[model samples]
Target: MILTSVLPELILLSADFGLIGSPRWRPLAYQYGAFWAGLLHGWQPNFAVQPVTMFLTHAFLHTGPMHLIGNMLALGVLGQMILERHNTGQFILIYIAAALGGGTTYGLLSHSAVPMVGASGAIFGLAGAQLVWRWQDQPKGDLSHLRRLAELCGGMLGLVVINLLMWWLQDGQLAWQTHLGGTLMGVAAAGLLPAQRPILLKIRS
Candidate 1:
């Protein structure tokens, strides 16, 4: 399923790089698929559905090859982690929720007229859910386990540092608001979703 989610982006990248298909495909995809803050302000494009569909569609688009690769890697790793503890439906639900959350956040906070595209928001959501699972899996009522919680805090701080560095490097072009919203939704979803029970096997003697 993770691979399935990556196919559209790969195809789009190919078109954008002129490897196959018309180069125009990339621009068209962005025109219809990328989220535009202006849309929220009643700036309608030719496509009527774009205003609503862009919430999820923009996640499948990428600004460049590196952007796609990074998000896909995170999706594969963190997504698998999520799938291990929940059913496919739950995974999909969390992903969709995160994407919508990210889009909503971007719509509200960002003033850029440029279309936003990327799966980083959804990927960050998976990371957030993974963090919650780690916290839940820790041994309870044990003072020694405090170190694990601290490590989780450190990990979150590290994410903040990385976001800051990327924002600085990109000249504040990063959609950090989307990342923030997605992560919060992911954490909320993980808390609300049920975890699967561990399967046990019996050995015959």
Candidate 2:
């Protein structure tokens, strides 16, 4: 899925000597982000240079297989949940917002000069949207429904907290800022999306 979605840009960006995530130049591409493709050889902090185009393309490029797998999994799960509660337009908007937020955060914070990549930021946003729904209401439907929702929420929350803590402890290369931005945007998107309370009959305490 990622190869089909991102391969085209990867090819185009590869030719441009300056593009950071140059798929044409596999070894080098590993280091830079799709956003950096335009900035590969150019001076940055200059929005006029090519920030707008990067805004859309950055989210498609990913760093590695692991990155793609994690992001795709989260996106698939939360995207379905969001779809259940909202329309396609809203989902698109949320995704865009997440991509932008993640990209901007990475651009502003990274000091290593490494180019960022992946749709992770957007996927994180979808996860956040699911969290928002859970927070708004506790177990309400079938005990099983409520239990699964609770389990999902708890697991996600735990993952985020643990990942953040690990980052703090090791000051590792993980995209902490990007994750935070995407997740927060995703949670906020839940509110923007339309909602319909699932029918719940109290069967037990």
Q: How accurate is candidate 2 locally (lDDT)?
A: 0.65
- On residues 87-188, what C-alpha lDDT tens digit does candidate 1 reach at each position? 889888889889989999999998789999988888888888888787777655443566767867877887788889989998988999999889888889
Number of the predicted model whose lDDT against the real structure is largest = 1
lDDT of 2 by residue, 84-195 (tens): 7667787788888887877776666655455566687887777777667765554544457667667667867775896677578747867777777777777777777667
All candidates: CA RMSD (Å)? 4.9, 6.4
lDDT of each: 0.82, 0.65
Runs in model 1 lying further than 4 Å from the true structure: 17-20, 144-152, 197-205
